[model samples]
Target: MAAHTAIARPPLVPEIPLHLATEITPIWQATEAWLGEQGIEPPFWAFAWPGSQALARWVLDEPGLVAGKRVLDFAAGGGLAAIAAARAGAAMAEAAEIDPLAHAATRLNARLNGVTVVEAPGDVVGSPCRWDTILAGDVCYEAPMTNHILPWLRRLAAEGAAVILADPGRAYLPGAGLREVARYAVPVTRELEDREERVVTLFRVLP
Candidate 1:
């Protein structure tokens, strides 16, 4: 894990550094092997996804969006967005993930950046949200996952929580009820995406 930590830097948000994989394949091989030994899936938390990068960027540039708000980073791999929110002066910032290993990484990454982010445990989607702002990055990459999670996000938005998502042209993102507030050309490895770079759109989920 130390070797993994050695390779990562906040390539997108350099000011707020994070432990991220330098490359896609090699890190996944090593991390997945480690996970296999532990009987779990490969930890995607080890890498900085383009969507998360875009979300973090927007938060830093427009801190007023999160300032004084309670924030929740859904599926907060590596907790980059959550850290950004905390740094942007959100009243509270918290992260939630399904994988225990990912949660461990989130805590470590939070510490690395000198931020206090509470770990929101249990089924994040099933619970009532108390946050004023909720951020989700790169979660629309899969169909089943998108189908299952979007409704919960919509519900949160309807309940007056400010739910937003950053996505890089994924197959499953819905066509309606998303207001694009920002667009970014995010750098990514070819192994993880078809393009070496992607244009990520930061969308505000609306009623």
Candidate 2:
């Protein structure tokens, strides 16, 4: 068996409560704990994706929105959004990520949150399973990935799934019919940095 070593971490700071409370924390202490336990470094998006925490925080604060809904958290990294959705009374919650490493981290975080997350990436095209709502956080920063995801999201909407996105005014978030439901001024740091770092808006994909 491989030897395990405890990783020391700085004490976590208090996170401010956003609109959605029971659903998520602005700073995901559970994800932090899970990452420490696994001793795995995070992927680029986890660090680079702007407005991720803000989105998760907002989702956590709004349980009524997700209540009784079947939710799919696409490209979930630390499973923050999925966890929040589950706590918000979503009938079903699942997470999907392209990277196997992210899937592992998502599962670890999910377990930390006392929830279950399906750890696999499925076809963006013609999904066999149906979901009432699809949650996407910080997925519109990259041009290529945005190009790939937007069409599929449109298709999902056409198929009767509601798509919600959390974006920090990224270049790609515009041109989509995403109406801003909530907004927050999230504190950012250069320590764990992002390209266009700052506060962001959480928007719901309108039909």
Q: Tens digit of lDDT per residue, candidate 1, span 39-75?
A: 3455688878888889899999999999999999888
Highest TM-score model number: 1
Candidate 2 residue spans exceeding 4 A from truth: 1-50, 122-129, 192-197
TM-score against truth, every candidate: 0.92, 0.72
- lDDT minimum window of 10 residues, candidate 2: 1-10
- lDDT by residue (tens digit), candidate 2, 30-117: 4456456543434432332445566566656777777898988887765667767876778988888765656655665556567766
Q: How many residue pairs clash in each candidate?
A: 1, 6
Model 2 residue 38 CA deviation in Å: 21
Best by lDDT: 1
